[model samples]
Target: MLFVSRAIDKLNDTIATAVSWALLLAVLICAGNALIRYSLNMSSNAWLEIQWYLFAAVFMLASPHTLRRDEHVRIDVVTGRFSRRTQVWLDLLGFVFFLMPVCLVILYYGIPFGLESLRSGEMSSNSGGLIVWPAKLLVAVGFALMILQGVSEMIKRVAYLQGRLDASAFTKHAVTPEEEIAAIKNANHLT
Candidate 1:
């Protein structure tokens, strides 16, 4: 179980790194597009479409890594009061009932959606815009990766409950503002 979890984590980590680069590329493209549009009064739909594609990829592909790192947003005001074990159990339930099912449904629908787009060789309406299939396909790929990460999380949560793994390591930890400030100070050598 641990092995599987680690493998999934590693895969998502790789995807997340690539997606991060995509984000940087998107930023660069945006800046370049703006400069060209204003200075040269020229722009290409291809470049604009590529930026949108990168943004979509960054959002979809990086989500699994966020889940793996236990960094997904939550309302901690209530969950904070629960015991750690209870929190783990709740998270396990959420993965089983919510995250997994949601991802699976998206994957179920997304595959055929992408396939149809590919079969039709769909193109963006804008002249010079990119083909639509790859962006359409990202939805399925993202959810497939998300499902794998959800399974990995569930495995770790169960392992923690069974006392086979440390709960603290697998669970989310909320950082306080003071801790955030201290980290910033340390990074700047202000402490």
Candidate 2:
């Protein structure tokens, strides 16, 4: 189980990095397009359409890693005050009641929608001209990755709750060198 979780984490990290770079590229492309249109008096319909597609890809590909890293926005007003055990229970409840159901629904519908688009050879209506099927397929792929990561998280949490796993064994947080340096600097400043 540890090996599996580690492998999943590695995969998620790779995908997240790729997605981040893709988003950066998208921003550069959009900036360049704007500059060309304003400064050069040239417009590109293709650039505009491609920007949207890249944005979609960036979000879709990064979602699973965001969940794995607990980076998603949450109210946390209440959960932040809870004990570790209570927080685990809250996470379990939210996962079973909310996250799982939503992912299942997306997986159910997204597959057929993407398949139909592929079958019909769907293309974007944008003046730039783009294939729609690949973007549509990202819906299913993203949800599937989310589901897998959720399962890994659930297993680790349940193991911790059952006393079969040490808290440190399942805990994901670790201080990086940069954070340690920052902490030391702050302490020195206080002195």
- Candidate whose TM-score is highest: 1
> What is candidate 2's lDDT per residue for 80-190, written digit by digit as tens?
798888888888787788888999999999999999999999988867678889889989988888888777777777887988776664445757899999999999999
- Candidate 2's TM-score reads 0.84
- The residue ranges of model 1 lying beyond 4 angstroms of the native Cα positions read 184-191
Per-residue lDDT tens digits for candidate 1, residues 70-133, read: 8898767888899989999889999999998889999999999999999999999999988999
lDDT score of residue 46 within candidate 1: 99
Which 10 successive residues of model 1 have the least lDDT summed?
167-176
**What 10-residue stretch in candidate 2 is worst by lDDT?**
165-174
